[model samples]
Target: MVMFAIIPYLALSAALDPLAPIIAGQLHMSAQTMSLGSGLGNAAYALGTVLAVQLGLHLPQRRMLLAYAALLVVGSVLTAVAQNAAMFIAGHTVQGLATSMLLIAAVPPLAIGYPRERLHTTVMIMNMGIFGAVALGPFIGGLQADADAWRPLFWIVTAVAVLALLLVVLTFEDAPPANPDAPRDLPAIALAAAGSLAAFLGASELTSHSFLDVEVIAPLLGGLALIAGLIVYQYRAAQPLLMVREMLTSAIPVAGVVTALFAAAASVSATALTASVLSETYGPVRVGLLFLPELGGAVIAAGVFGLVIARRSLHYLPLVGMILLAAGILVFRLGMPDSQPLALLGSALTGLALGATVAPALFVAGFSLPSASLPRVFAVVELLRAVAAFMIAPIFAHFAATVTGDLNEGTNIALWIGLGLALAGAALGVTIYALSGARPQTPDLDTFLAGQRPAWYSPPLLSRLRRSHDLDDLDVALPVPESVD
Candidate 1:
């Protein structure tokens, strides 16, 4: 159910790259409209993370999960049978919102509900379901495009959504609200929704307008400012909706967040940008075929995640993933779209990088906090991850198109930046670990599941600078939020 519900939408997100033109032509829509619709969809996805957390705090768990799935089905149907732009955009936006909501509502339980022995399986499923689908999307899109048909793929996604909904019903179990007493935090919700929507909206405008144009820059900067304001507010609020302060103040969680964000931002060159360049030379089918190796890489990473999930080595997974990601970027730079071997190798490595980095970083963050706070912790990390990953693509795309007046030259230049992001992320995470004197220690999943303590020790920021001999005064742990004051 988790895999089915999640894969269709995420796959569709990437699949849209090739399907967009066919969609635009059939719907009698302009390029800008398609861009606008996609922008809104991305916004829903990014904002829905925070919204899911909020709902979890106050709603019936399983009941809401079912609702989210049903909503997803409706959205999928709308897109599948759409006759106009409004229907398609509305459905796409809902699919985005419902997918994230389903993710937050469904995944944490799978992570913490089972025994330690079973968590390895959960990690593998989650990694494959979330990231693997993304890895497979281009091939699926290319097939549909080569067929010169988009409805078939959309129908398939709708069918998957329906299956997911049925799975929800068969597996239903009643559960109470997580914490009814938690603050409403309407302000946080407003800020998150507005910031994500405006930011993506502005970025999407780049398809039709220059970066400096008011349509692109005004809302872009404003949305970013609002997101900054949201973080400050959440960090300072007496009873916040999310665990902003705790994650930011702890060395492990902070490192995890940095690793996740940077890996996501850097991996774009191997996927969307390269696909764009390839599309100019090869037809959709061939382009998708060349990138088919990405799915294999993702599968390997997923298997590796299952093996290391219970071990202390999980902490280093993202670092290794960063190294792989950098190698992949370097390969792409060797001559993406032109060098078939490098493109194949680069796609494989990038698939590995993405699957390895984000999932492990998320778990590392979860392990740094108590198990009960996993949803909130995931919400925060994912929100930032979505922003860094989704928003950076368009900006990079624009840069690649205009910088050298040569598409290939400009794309190679962008690959250089992606390489920097990967390295910088690795360096920052390593630096934080060093500064905090944090070691890669084994996590006690049993203790974490009991909500008794975090799986592993996460020292406060700058612990190396402040600790005494053997850290006598630092014995006490900072309190994590469970309910509103």
Candidate 2:
């Protein structure tokens, strides 16, 4: 069921770049519009995530998963057959919602069902779908986009989605235990979904233009208000949809947010900027082909990091990725005037960097907090990353529009912007690693989830992973033992 749930995103993420140019051509719109569509899809995905968290509390898990998977099949068809931009967006939205719900619902059961010691590794492997999609999606989807019209690409997506849905129905058998302590609230879920959608739209719009405009201001402000209300309601309501306390204080949540920002920034910047420039420079077929090395790199890196590297040591992996990304992007930007080969090399390096870093970050984020909090915290972080992807892409586009005299010039500006983000994100990762003290490794999840503490405590799981990877011990800054009683 879990694997099936992530299949659409895997296919979509890779295909997104290739698909954008076709959509733009058909719609007779600017690349910015295509960028907006990407943002919209991500925003819808985030909305689905938030809703899934609440759905788990109130609804039957087996039924919800089944419904979600069915939606995926339908949404895929809608996307494939869409004649206009509106239909495309609608299809993307439905897929986004279904994808999120399916993915989120799969987690809690795993947490409760699996042994604590193996949870981190288990989740990490499962999350490879995100990376797997990124690595393989572009190549497979790109081929279709290259050979046939873009419309056919949707058919492919539909087929994959249908297959996934069927697999889910066959595989997903366990049902969640009824939680008498947790009550469901319909109103709260609705408010959160609406607020998230508004916020994503508003945030995304801000990238292209000023937030001061009426169109931008209204959605942004309204979304903020609704989200604010959500928080207040959660705090006061009998049964809250979000696990606010755990989300804020947990090491995992903090790390996840930071990780998502950097990971998303790296991959999103690469794909969006590359798509925009390459569509004009190389044409769609070549542009899709350009991502081949990237896919290979991401797959190899993710496999090694997930399978071979210990979880704790993986924190620094993203940092390493950022550095490679910066280097690749810098090379691509500076060398663009020189040759296509240079740009290709740069793309390869960037793909390799993303491959190495993104999966590990997600693994850490997904497994860090308690099982109960996974969906909500992951949703929030994913949402923030969506905000970044939407907000950053248009900024790059607008910069290209104003500063550049030509497509190449605009690409240069976008590349530089991407490099800057990579550097900044890398630096933040270093700071986080330094602050997290070294602790001995434990095989049990109880240690990580242990809210109770002795008078004196030590650093948690991060340090253990770091040491296992032979990284230097981070200095202890906070008290080791947190007092629970």
Candidate 3:
């Protein structure tokens, strides 16, 4: 199950490497326009996540996997055979939807099938595959683009999808459905989706345009406001979109979110840096060869973290990995020579960091959620990471382009950013470890509910929602309100 999930992530990211150049040269399009293809695809994918929650209600998990895999195959085939750039972009847009569906389908098996003790470790191992593919995909796809044609890479990805489909059918079995009596908060769900979209769109715009620009600020602010409102509404409502009470009151979940941000930024920075350096410095093919060591490292990290590590405190491993990441990036940026062996070692070190951190961070995050909440939790974090990778990477490129007026200089600048992000992540990891060791008593969901009612509950809707749960009911959950005193 783990290996199958890993394959889809690997295959999807492979095309991301060849996409920009292929669109530019083949389509005769400008960089800005080609970038839109990525933005649109990402937005579609984000929206698809909300749809996944509903779809899970109606469909069998294994069947959903098969259907979504078929879509990926179709999308890949379309991309492989595309003659014009429009056709190619369309293919990717569909691919985004298909991949989102695949991601949603995979979550249940991971969440329900695995034991809680192994959950974090399993997730971390899976993430290593994900980041490994992401780190290495660009190099390989870029090489193929240089050596032959970019189109064939799509066919290769399609083959992998077929394999994943077979694996799903063979290994996955559906669990009992959620009780129909459980309250459905459609309004909250819609708000959550809208807020997520606005935030992502806004964040993506932050790099390309001014924060004050109408296109950017309106969406960003609107998104933040909407998400805040969703939390407020969910806090008092009968049921919630994200089970906010459980998330807020638990130190584990809070720690999970922090770890996710740090780990995601650290690992993603490497891929973005590689894209800038390899595409400009060595040509795509040599860059592909350069990443081989990184791929090997990722495989090793996945196995060691996933299969061998038994410690619940394994969250600290990523902190160690962050230190290694900082050292590796510094070494690579400062020590790159003409020698192939030297370059390979630098790449290997970078890969090792990615392998070590990516999975472990994801494991910790997902471990804090119940099975039913896994998709929503994973979607938010994964989507945030994706947005960060796409939007922020270009910022580094743009900074390099603006300041040094040289691609190589720009890559070095990006490396510095990568190093800073890694160090920051390490700091956060240390804080979380210290906090966990302190063993501060967490407030129970029911205790938080028993606090005196605020004036806002005078409103009919809010008041009605609040009445649904008993003030002293031990099991009642409560999300943090938008404004908490």
Q: Which residues of candidate 3, in runs, are more than 4 Å off? A: 1-15, 111-128, 169-176, 183-238, 307-309, 336-343, 369-373, 403-410, 436-485
- The most accurate candidate by lDDT is 1
lDDT of each: 0.91, 0.64, 0.60
**Tens-digit lDDT track of model 2 for 181-275:** 57676777777667767766765565456647775678877976886677677657665666654444444445546756765665555666666
Tens-digit lDDT track for model 1 on 217-295? 9999999989889999999999988899999999999999999999989998767898899889898988888788888
**Best first by lDDT, ranked:** 1, 2, 3
Model 1 clash tally, residue pairs: 0
Deviation in angstroms for 278 in model 2? 2.7
Which consecutive 10 residues in model 1 have the weakest lDDT in total?
Answer: 469-478
Clashing pairs in 2: 298-355, 312-465, 313-465, 457-480, 457-481
> Which parts of model 1 have CA positions greater than 4 angstroms off?
466-485
- TM-score for predicted model 1 compared with the true structure: 0.95
- What does candidate 3's lDDT look like per residue over 1-485, in tens digits? 44444454345555465556664677675565566566556655655665566566545656666777777767667777877768766777777777776776675466455544664466556666676776667676766777656656667776776777677678666654343445566776687567756765665564457556787778868976876786578557665545555554444555555555665565545555654555555767776777678777776776667553445445565666677778777766774433456557766777777777755655455545544566666665565555555445545555555567676676677678878888887776556445444222222212212222210111121222344444645345655459758
Better of 1 and 2 by TM-score: 1
Top-scoring candidate (TM-score): 1
Runs with alpha carbons beyond 4 Å of true place in candidate 2: 17-39, 83-86, 107-128, 137-142, 177-180, 183-191, 202-213, 217-240, 308-311, 403-405, 433-485
